[model samples]
Target: MSTVEVILQSCLSKPAGNSLLVEQYVSDTASGRRYLLGRNEHAAEIMQMIEVDGIIDDFATNGTTWNNKPVLTTEQLPDQSMVVNCAMCIAPVSAARRLQKHGAIEILSLAELCSHLPQRFKLPWFVSQTRDEIRNHLSAWNSLSTALVDKQSQQTLNDLLHFRLSGDYHYMSGYSVRPEEQYFEPFIEPSAAHVFVDGGGYDGDTTEQFCHRYPGYRQVYLFEPTPTNLANARRRLKHQRNITFIAQGLSDQQGSLPFDTEAGSASAVDPQSSQQIQVTTLDQAVSEPISFIKMDLEGWELQALQGARIHIQDDRPSLAIAVYHQAADFRRIFDYVTGLYPDYQVYLRHYTEGWSETIMYFIPANIKQN
Candidate 1:
């Protein structure tokens, strides 16, 4: 296809109707980059792509820290009240809420930021489905979006898609989801004790939440590949006996591949890294029955589902797969899962501030019969 066909000029962010949103952006941008909140390497890329004029004020260093810019730690953060939230993937929700309690205005989102910049997210990746794979992927999204059962589910899916295709957070207005709620979505009654597969089990946070939410689980399979992370998860759930720590990553195949970003919980299978790690398909690795599966495997949700096809087809376990890791995943994983088990009730829930933790739940129609 030609470049003109690939480019989505029609869907680009317009600046005419969004004057109210970027009133602060015009004034504040002149002084300097007041506060760029993105902390990871992604934030670094944003900084590099578009020059950040001022300090990168972020104390919470979970992943790889910034190098080029002057990073102000905790003490200096008090002085810098964030006038503009420059596309922080996960907004500082708690702090924003706290400030709101004391009568501060709500923070801006990527959509609000889009009013100032030339772009919101990546260009026309959605409409550029000229290739067979992309065409199929787009078809899956359209199919699932239409056949989504509930109106709310469909809207949520669209809203998340809107944010992904264009970095707009309008759909996220007046919504807050607790972490416990992320795994245990409403509308479906979860059995008190059930077999659980916790994919991308980072530092036992979800495991701890799962224990509280569904106490006395029959069994739990916690999958984490990085050595340091596995050790951390082990240490966190050391006292628990029902927990089974699988020291490998999940994918469509069972073999070794180079894992990326081995720094704590952010590690995932990436081509850039040469560090080799063992990865196995769920069908080949898991022997017992699975009642529920929650995958947040970076961007490998679809591939993992393919590996676990046999299990899903047989057991029809409730799924809480992360779809916000990439745009197509929203449809690809959901389509495949529901296609495997047609009677499942689907629900969309956004766990984080933006499109990061948008989890798609698929519960079997006869879940109570389990």
Candidate 2:
């Protein structure tokens, strides 16, 4: 059976919580022999739920303490230590290999360690719903595979599917770090008349890249709902000409919705947050003809797409939408875009070594396919 099929079957046949990998590791390890790899928010979460001797971070000072745990590099990792990888942004297998090379005995990914934990502890994109969603939408997934314009895109889709289903970072071993070149693919031809829209423009990094790429662009609209992020974007792109900053979230409709401000770039419309931000549809927000739109609104891409249907149908702007936030988005976003304009040539690219930063590009039919 294929890797995707094998993983799907495995998830379908076996129930979760059957094997508590974290418990097993703890039971097998002696006192003070446990370590966690990486010292990010993920590591903090893991530390709250379990005990560890120290946190391993190559960049941190050897004697410093992170979350009150001793910070040590892989070079200082004790012999026969059991390490749990908490670096969600990078490939777990690569981290494991590094730890092993440094004399560490055992390594487990955050996903594998938390696989038996409650659903609340599951990481984004690696949640329990992933397998069932893929299984239910098998036909849609197949259609998306056929819709991709290149073999690399098809392989990326397959690899991502396998990784999400199995929580095996080995599938992402071939991925490289190229987040800077994300929205600006070689397939897209730059034009001086390009009018760009930066949806979810956090800190103006993407807008800066766009300005750098298309220096003579006529106009640029940057939308960021978070107050701090909007201020940062403005400060960063203050000198750029013909730029409009809209401090509102993008959605299918106009209104206010609760938003979580503390999550930084991952912030979105969360009903749980006491803070609320105004939202507007792209069609209503911009009256000018748009040549391109790049959206990375966490998991709200679909809703924003629905709101921008008019612009997509009329302007047919080249689209670069993030699809890694949710598993169903792999097929849902492609289907939605093509459903609106059947001639859009679709392409997929992943930036990180993990499940994040998967972008689905939609180049209009008028643009010559490369």
Q: Residue 40, candidate 1: how far off, in angstroms?
A: 5.6
Tens digit of lDDT per residue, candidate 2, span 1-370?
Answer: 5445665777445444335555676566456788888877777876776677898888886589988889988888878787877766655656767887975467776666555554535553465567778778777776787788999887887787767775656667888778799888887767513899999999999999999988979899999999999999999999999999999999999999999988988998888899999999999999977888999999999999999999898888889999988888877899899999999989998898887899999988775321
The Cα error of candidate 1 at residue 200, in Å, is 1.5
Single out the weakest 10-residue window by summed lDDT for candidate 2.
11-20
Leading candidate by TM-score? 2
Which pairs clash in the backbone of model 2?
Answer: none
Each model's lDDT: 0.65, 0.81
- TM-score for model 1? 0.76
Instruction: Tell how far residue 292 is off in model 1, in angstroms.
Output: 0.8
